[model samples]
Target: MFSKIDLKSDRFVVVFINDILIYSLDEYEHAEHLRIMLQTLRDNKCEFWLREVGFLGHIVLTNGIQVDPSKIFAVVN
Candidate 1:
């Protein structure tokens, strides 16, 4: 059901299972993208959540993405 909609490029969007993450270089672009993505989803009658994006063992930060400390402990413990 989700494979039909075209978002132009994969650089701005990431999809995993039921989660979708839309990102941009600045707040303005992000907002515009949110509007477009939300409208697209709405037009498709799809439900979505506006939550902080998570990448399992990876940490997401303002400066960059990092590996979760717990993941390293779990790996080497």
Candidate 2:
């Protein structure tokens, strides 16, 4: 399990890592929560492949979880 980033802004939360940008949006109160989540991931040193990121509205799924899906790659099996 990973700790979550907490964001206090309604705007989207974007983190620039390895030249790629990971973005996520949430309700105003959720802003701080997003920040905390990001921080937790950083603390744990989780390896994230930006190219495989996904998005769903305000949700961002990077590793199998429900995410934006924009940077996620489709697996051909």
Candidate 3:
């Protein structure tokens, strides 16, 4: 559904699946560009947590980093 877009300017993209960061790239940045990229992932049955989307290299959590015991264990194993 999505194809790589070659642009004449510098842009960056970071895509994640199910709260786990997966892809990073430098390319075009536009609504359609993001849409197509997301649609392509959906078409391939990739899952995402819409509420968890955030900046690259950072994890999304309530009240900042999750330090609870249960949540920590669940994430680690």
Candidate 4:
């Protein structure tokens, strides 16, 4: 399923292990990406938690992706 998303996302989605990262340059584009991504997941009947999705030391949230602060702290110290 992750691979499917990666393949269909037109460079807007990435999957690493069990996590996914979807991104775009602006709010509207981001929404469209999210809509497409979520539709794919739902079509596949995937068990998903929007807030719990992330990858490569970042978290996907309602607003956008954010770097995990713990990772930042670990690198800074």
Query: What would the per-residue lDDT of candidate 4 be over residues 1-77, giving only the tens digit for each residue?
Result: 66677687568876767656666777788788778888767546444435555467776676777898887996788
- For 4-77, candidate 2 gives per-residue lDDT tens digits of 22242234444433222334543454455445556545535544434354333334344345534343445421
Candidate 4 to truth, TM: 0.54
TM-score on alpha carbons, each prediction: 0.66, 0.22, 0.27, 0.54
Poorest stretch of ten by lDDT in candidate 3: 1-10
Q: Pick the candidate with the highest TM-score.
A: 1
Clashing pairs in 4: none
- Hey, what RMSD does candidate 3 come out at? 8.1
Model 1: residues with Cα > 4 Å off, grouped in runs: 4-11, 42-52
Of the two candidates 2 and 3, the one with more favorable TM-score, higher being better, is: 3
Best by lDDT: 4
lDDT of 3 at 52: 45
lDDT of each: 0.64, 0.41, 0.41, 0.69
Better of 1 and 2 by lDDT: 1
- Comparison by lDDT, 1 against 3, better one: 1
Model 1: per-residue lDDT, tens digit, 1-77? 35733444465877767656677888888878777777567546443343443576676666778787877996778
Q: How many collisions per candidate?
A: 0, 30, 0, 0
**What are the per-model C-alpha RMSD values against the true structure?**
4.1, 10.4, 8.1, 4.8
Worst 10 residues of 2 by lDDT: 1-10
Residue 63 lDDT (model 2)? 38
